[model samples]
Target: MADRQLRTVLEGGGFFEGPRWHEGTWWVSDFYRHTVSRVAPDGAETVVVEVEQQPSGLGWLPDGSLVVVSMKDHRVLRHADGSVSTYADVTEHCGGHLNDLIVDAQGHVFVGDFGFDLMGGGAAATASLKRIGPDGSVSVAAEELQFPNGAVITPDGGTLVVGETLGNRYTAFDLGADGSLTNRRVWAALGPEVTGTTVDEVLGQLVVAPDGCTLDAEGRIWAADAVGGRVVRVAEGGQIVDEVAAPAGLGVYACMLGGDDGRTLLMCCAPDFYEHNRAPVREAVLVATEVDVPHAGRP
Candidate 1:
């Protein structure tokens, strides 16, 4: 299922979001250009840290330092040797801003938020996923969830999946060797159970809004149907099998699966998911293609 033919590994961003290929290159997060760059697989770019309470997801910490996800001050900065600080504040357990995170392999992060006030329209509550620890401390590793953005951590780390952008679904848990998340379930549901509550009545019963995700090597899950511009690949129970779409007028939201044999899948396009038209536009982009499993967990 490798629908290859979509290159363009970087562009005038302003929206992009937590991608991550690590050590080799690709890390990302731009939300209105508050920076956190690093691309280079021929596209050259490099900025790596400017945050200003904007950068989303991104991980690393097992002494390699990097952390990020300062999404509007809910904190989690770290960056080591180069200096950035605030390794975990959780702003008293967020309820609106912070979004997206994942960092297991003993560093254990797992963040998420946007339980309400989504871009200021308000009314769509329920969110929680916290976990920080590794000496930074912060807890509440799972709760109602509903907008928990993106997350992953498996490769023997004992599962953690997560993507519930407004709750079209992805869920899953049970990782506790100290990170604690416990059984929980529903690792794929892309369609029912939205039950509206504003935000245009739960985005008019979204059919597949599960934004930002990864995890391949057959365990499936590519997800990023953020409004269905497309990415889907899910396979744990709500079977979608494969999908990609999102090149005309763009709108992919997020995706990863890195390169150098990980079967690259990147993608993060834009043109929608408004924060006032992507915070005053630079248009956003970071595409790639080629897929057939090869990336397995944690990011």
Candidate 2:
């Protein structure tokens, strides 16, 4: 178990999310900056691609090229050998803006949508979990999800788990060979879902706004509690087994279990998440803390 002590890995970011540790570096997306960047072990950052429509989730293809979620346009963009292009267009199939995504070993991508106009102020609505195959074809993997965000696939490739932010729980699905998701069930339920427009009202009802998360070698989940300013490691049954809180004025928007040995838990800290507030500032930072469990599973 770790405490609240966290050290800065990188700073001056504009609302970071979708962190992935791959190929000896940390890749993440800056929502406001509209860029996907990679941070080295020594905290150096290099912009991989500048997405015009805004970038959220990040993954890679089988050919080692980068794939990013274009949030506002509801598209997935691929960057290969220094060129960016559309990999899939999911606008007609999606209700709202697209969020985070996970790419399996076979290059199958599972992505989530917002379901409502979150930034512009809309009522809570159900969303869809979409899957994009290697051939650039799209399909609805699942539906009626309440704000599906971060997602991860088990190392054995048998299961896929996603964080439903508004639902206060993580949902699991059986991943079939044909890219179909089945056997949907609640993997962890921190609290019941709450519907509200104001921040206080929504926060009051949520036990934990489970945001971006990563899986550890022990089969546990390290989920960022967006409203609680803490990153909690939850066991299979939704029990809070371990946690690490951020300092005042900082909230953990996303997290990844990564490092040379995968024992480092990287926290994406930001001052706030509101579009009006966070879009104008560069107060976000990348912080790291040592953990006992190393990482396991897909991006």
The candidate scoring highest on lDDT is 2
How much lDDT does each candidate structure score?
0.85, 0.89
Candidate 2 accuracy as TM-score = 0.96
Q: Write the per-residue lDDT of candidate 1 for residues 100-133, one digit (tens) a residue.
A: 8888888888888887788889888888989988
Residue pairs clashing, model 1: none
- For each candidate in turn, give its C-alpha RMSD to the true structure in angstroms: 18.1, 1.4
Pull out the clashing pairs in model 2: none
For each of the candidates, give the backbone clash count.
0, 0
Model 1 — which ten-residue stretch has the worst lDDT? 1-10
RMSD in angstroms, candidate 2?
1.4
Worst 10-residue lDDT window, candidate 2: 194-203
Model 1, which residues run further than 4 Å from truth?
1-19, 24-56, 59-65, 69-73, 79-94, 101-112, 117-164, 167-195, 198-204, 213-222, 225-255, 265-299
